[model samples]
Target: MNGYRKLPTAVNYQFAEDLYSVFKTFGLDLDRLSYSSQTGQMKKLIEELETPDNLQKISQLSLDADFADMKTKHEAFETIFADQAGANADLRQMTSATAIRKILEKNLKTYFNLLTVMKEVAGWELLYSDTNELVKAAKNSEIKRKDENPS
Candidate 1:
């Protein structure tokens, strides 16, 4: 076995490339977006995750938060799709609502892999629900308030 194998980019950088293909009809331009450069953020962050403290900071991260966070690769693609970066047309033009829904479904494992990684990094704690899906961090005050005063 090779002493040092290349780290997986498929789950990180390739995701961006795949999104470019999926939405290329919407005038998506990976190069114009500086796509190659953008992947470094994930590479760097994943490297930082080697540290316990750094990993802890992201442990409570939900999948939505990962995609929505401005600094993440996921957000870059999100912006393109939402036309936040001056995209040519809304998604409904080339694809239907159903196609949009199914687009990411095939990659749920890749998405789940990210979540599972956070789970292990956080020592398999509260980042996930019993169903192994990422969730919001539990808030004692919020839970108590709700119990004390029902909505």
Candidate 2:
């Protein structure tokens, strides 16, 4: 999949600094937020800017303002991180490889049955032949393994 590429660490650092400058220019207190690193600071800043009153404050700012630039950078950063997080969560939720292979095997069997019935249909002959070749190869491999083992 052509998914989002995470921003580099240096870019994240720059985003935090730019956000700090914009907030400072607007007299927003740096002490009001609690965070350890640049990424954390950016996250906290995003959270702070999401509040109802703060949202109103930012909404009134001109598009050419530093705050506007800060918002754009923050959104880009959030989207990349969110994509990475979602991919990781999906990975964690996946079943074991053996289980996945079993499911795929079952699906392929059902698909081959359909292809067998459709072989008389136009354009399906090549597909059915190709699929049969795959099944033949797999069965031949298994037979070779059994002969070699002789147990």
Candidate 3:
């Protein structure tokens, strides 16, 4: 009820604040949520804040947008790990087996932890497998191709 009165305007402001808070907590620069950019979804959100019904719809849109933003960040983190693994190819050749194992184990654990956090926040598994068999197959594939294969 509190957020439903002013309708879209209130919802927009709440969403903007929520996004800003998320960015701040994550140490991301607030400018990344720029309102002026054509690609910025927040601009569309503000525009959608004209009426109560519109605000209710916009609130759902904002949640979808937040989920998308989180997914993007998760992908970027994956890309960084992939890039690092690619760059360290020479290390694989030079380092001892124990050293390489330690490095990989640490990185894999970190990546898994990140994925867990993402899953918890999004309230769903990030992996697309709808069935257990598909999930097992995907996991097997990942294990088989453990080395970083840069895209």
Candidate 4:
């Protein structure tokens, strides 16, 4: 897989850092994971699996501002919509089912987008783990075959 082979620790670090920065920019701490620490850990882990040469190349790519902006917007929307039950207290007092439904529909979209982003992140993590396992298995099999053939 080209994506797996080209995976660079530096790029991963920049991605994590940019994601953190975007969240901070929107005044959301997220409170799930520490970005810098996670980046450092990912760097070390990738270094163990990938070649030094490819690692250097990946580190050179700059952090993508557009991606960061999209993430920031998404987080901002999430923060606002997450407090919907509280936010719509006034609307609820008005007792209009139509208005409440509209608000809920909007909030639901934001919530769905948040879930999509989370799912993408999870998919990437799974892909990385699977790739690492496949690589290890290939290496082990090659070694075993060599032992059998005495080559």
CA-lDDT, candidates in order = 0.47, 0.66, 0.54, 0.52
Q: Write the per-residue lDDT of candidate 2 for residues 1-151, one digit (tens) a residue.
A: 0011123344234444444454555445544643234446666666776666555544443223665687788678668877887898998898989999999999988999999999999999999999999999999999999999997
Q: For model 1, how does the per-residue alpha-carbon lDDT over 1-151 read when each residue is reduced to its tens digit?
A: 0111123443343434333333343333334545535444443444444355433434433223543363565556646645643454544357776776787766765766776777766555564455363223345556787899875
Sequence-dependent TM-score of model 1 = 0.22
TM-score of every model versus the real structure: 0.22, 0.36, 0.28, 0.21
| TM-score-best of 3 and 4 | 3
Write candidate 4's Cα lDDT for 39-147 as tens digits.
4444443343235543343344332354345446645655665577466786667768887799998996686566545655846656555555776798899999999
- Runs of candidate 1 with Cα error greater than 4 angstroms are 1-94, 130-151
| Candidate 1 positional error at 11, Å | 87
Measure candidate 3: CA RMSD.
Answer: 24.2
Which residue pairs in model 1 clash with each other? none
Candidate achieving the largest lDDT:
2
Ranking of all predicted structures according to lDDT, beginning with the best and ending with the worst: 2, 3, 4, 1
For 27-143, candidate 3 gives per-residue lDDT tens digits of 344346432242244334343343465445446545556545745764575577568867888677786988889999899678666665666465446442234356479888997
**Model 4 accuracy (lDDT, Cα):** 0.52
Error of 3 at 57 (Å): 11
How far does residue 5 in candidate 3 sit from its true spot (Å)? Answer: 16
Off by over 4 Å in 2: 1-94
